[model samples]
Target: MRKGLFFLCLVLYAFSVTLTVFVQHIGIQDRLLKIVCTLGILLSFFAVLAMLFLAFSLKGGVESLEQKENPAEKIPSKEKYLEFAARSGLSRRETEIGWLVLNGLSNIQLAETLYISLATVKKHLTHIYEKTETSGRKEFAEKVMAFGF
Candidate 1:
């Protein structure tokens, strides 16, 4: 949500800046238009700057929320897990499911969490094991845990 707001602020800033510049160009020959355009440009510039400040102020809160939700630090060596998962050609979806499995979610639970069928979850697990060179769920979980994610 914070990210969405930050992006929205950025988009508004870009749009305001662009509109102000375009208006200024169009008002080059009209005194009244020039005055309005100049005011608008100044207002937009300040608004954008203010929004940028707000966005920066909100960043730390967003980061802390992200850390609280995922706690990658607690998980352990997340960068290495990502590298290993990438090299193994595990799709993004597979990696997410693997994380759930490592956290000890049942197939039904995984299905509910992922909004997929149990069979689909099972299928993904099969591919996960094959890609990770593990024989079963237990081994896969052990491997991921070893990586700390």
Candidate 2:
């Protein structure tokens, strides 16, 4: 809904700019028309500034929400992760992949770090999920945190 309003405002501003140009071209020469035309041109800059403000503000808000959700200032050590993985019943390879996952590595990064293919990384993740009894990454992370990691 907010996005729709933003597009609507942009379209209206565009129309206003065109109207300003057309009136100025026809040589209306009215003082009020000149004032409105100048304001219309100035509004383009205002619109761009408003959009930049919204983008940064929205990103900051999302980051705050994410921090509230995770809030892990320091990651547990490798030994700690291994202990957790052992308790979770992860195999050797699964433990390695799960450790990277806990450390916030992407699948490609995990594959590169482990010298495995993407398919192999995914397979190990599947096994990790099964052993941890979690359906997905987010659930697995939550389970790990709940396990006092």
Candidate 3:
């Protein structure tokens, strides 16, 4: 829609310029030339206005979609998780794993990201679960949120 409006505006502008030049060179009567020029100017003005309206509306729609798709605004920050780990008596490695888990990384992904083996990632998760007195991922997340982490 935006591209179409822009193309329409371009065509109208070109036509207006061509009509003005042709009217001037062809020795038309002054009254007819004035009427033609006025009509052409009005058409060009409306085309520009339509293009501006489409551009702004499309921009607004894209911004709205971005906000809807991202909702990260409501999620807590990484620092909050770090602080939660500290308060929960987690060691540095456990805290690191906890942060990744809380952010929704899988054990395999965590292993890849931290450059550790899958067994090592599982071991860290077990330690975090034990330290937080939680059974698994779901409970761990619930506990952290309950504690205002």
TM-score of each: 0.46, 0.50, 0.49
Off by over 4 Å in 1: 1-75, 146-149
Best by TM-score: 2
lDDT of 2 by residue, 2-82 (tens): 465566557766876787788789998889988888887788667766666666676788898777645344456677677
Error of 1 at 124 (Å): 0.4
**Per-residue CA lDDT of candidate 3, range 1-149, in tens?**
67787788878977987887788778688897879987987887887787788778889988987767432333357777677788888999998888778777899999999999999999989889988899999898878776653
Which pairs in model 3 have colliding backbones? none
For TM-score, candidate 1 versus 2, the one ahead is: 2
The Cα local distance difference test for each model comes to 0.76, 0.78, 0.81
The local lDDT score (0 to 100) that residue 83 gets in candidate 2 is: 82
TM-score of 1: 0.46
Worst 10 residues of 1 by lDDT: 69-78
**Regions of model 2 farther than 4 Å from truth:** 1-74
Worst lDDT window (10 residues) for model 2?
68-77
Q: Where does model 3 exceed 4 Å of error? A: 1-75
